[model samples]
Target: MRSAPGEFEIIRDYFADAPIGEGVVLGVGDDCALLQPPAGALLATSVDTLVADRHFPASADPAAIAARALRVNLSDLAAMNAQPLWFTLALTLPHSDAAWLQKFADGLLQTAKAYGVSLVGGDTTCGPLSITIQVTGSSVKPLRRDGARIGDAVYVSGELGAAAAALPVVLGQKLAGEPDRDAAERAYYFPEPQLATAAAIGDIASSALDISDGLLADLGHICAASGVSADIDLHALPVAPLARQLAGERALELAASGGDDYQLCFTVPQEQVATLEKLGLDAVCIGTIVEGQGEVHAWLDGERWFPEAAGYEHF
Candidate 1:
């Protein structure tokens, strides 16, 4: 038999004191989480969770945990070109440790402050040390994956595969003073969500999304969402030198099927190439969205490169 799911009684006694945001006439203690949407701007909301052994190591630094937990959610807001305004955190720690909470909260506040976001509310409880943050943002017109069109040039904001490369090291696999271990570990620990870059994309990019589930899989999302297919040049993929050092010639495999790279993969009209170039985003034209459907293709030196696996999948 399964254990009973957590109930509101448990939620209220522990987490009821957290402040509700602006215009929240009646807060979470009641029958529902009631709030009035902020004036003028459209609301954007996203929820993300980080599990101890799954998303990060149990031994991972608290500050890094706090930062990454927030960054990934912020990446979703960025994809919509929304300016994050506030967030609610729900933390489930194995046990209440004052020092750990202090460090984690401090990191959360610092990162939120840097992004001009406030912690409006949250819930805390006892569990297996998991963190879930729900964030809200404001936007004039939110970008959607449905807008991609044929002939649009697909671009990614930064290098990929560092986080995937770090997986082995996280599992206690020894490395020979390898720099990829450090780089990939950093990528996994402190994932830069490219919020500013994504925000700047604005109407320029017809479609956009953060690459959390590897390049090929996430690009497949855009294609499926927009009813299009993409032809990515495997050689054109911006493989970081550190990732190259780690995987050797199989670097493309890492970039293709390795997940956890939170880079923004987007499509822009060919006309906006110059504008995006001026942004100095370390952007690369990796592929083109075409009028088709189904799996995205990776062309390596004019031949197809099909990985034995697709990407990281929970369950």
Candidate 2:
């Protein structure tokens, strides 16, 4: 009888042939990847781990899970106004399933190619199923959390709350029509990284971050880092339509406090607002920075509003 494929054999078969991009000196099959980062550009790197049943449903499609893992990590690069360059995937598998690994690798490499990032190197280990991806990119004039100033305009790229609303459908806890189910799956599995918008606003935005932990919660990070506060107009939010369909009256609250949209939330100084407008980006100003310590205040129809949940907490 044939034995199951070992760790190195699995890597050699499924992940060895990833597309090699410009800066890759040595890619897979080596102990470590040798990369040549672009001169005169700062390197921005971020890592994220998605555990089965926590970040994603354990029984979901392997390909979809792989795509989600890589895409979300790439979102971190976008938030820093970085150009996609390279990434590493550390995969922990309960067992060496050849079919599952092939599907996962296919999804991961396809998404990497689409985003112009190359897979460098990573490790495979035996454990509970989890995927950890670390992405590195080059950035010129990178946006940061501490760059927001009082009087700056707060903005977000694209709509929000769709992914959070899709949770029920994704987990199979709720049934939906075909259209809603497809929309929910798309939002949950294949969130866009907003790299183009981030690049467009890189020079203009004073502060920026990707909204992984709800708009209000992530915006508070910028506030805390910049020693400022924000005043958000609830009516100005561009809530996703899918959120309204799934979450109903709670759509607004979900948009404010639900996580996993992977959209960019940024601040622009008053002087650069005109410049930003000229760029014709798909971004909307939702609020303004105010002189206060790290607090975010929301007003709905001129009345103070608060969300029931702050955001996702790991602990």
What TM-score, computed on C-alpha atoms, does each candidate reach?
0.86, 0.96
Which ten residues in a row are the worst by lDDT in model 1? 1-10
- Candidate 1 overall lDDT versus native: 0.78
Off by over 4 Å in 2: 1-9, 175-179
**Model 2 lDDT tens row, 42-142:** 99999999999999988899999999999999999999999989998888889989889999989998998899899888878888999989999999979
RMSD of each: 3.7, 2.9
| Model 1 TM-score (2 dp) | 0.86
On the 0 to 100 scale, the lDDT of residue 302 in model 2 is 93
Q: CA shift at 296, candidate 2, in angstroms?
A: 0.5
- Model 1 Cα lDDT, one tens digit per residue, 1-315: 344433334444333334344655655444445566778889989999999988888787787788889988998998888888778778888887767776776677767777876665566677899999998898876888888889999998788877777777756677666554556667777787777887788858898888888889988988999999999998888876656776666667888888777888899998988888888776899999887994698998889989778866779
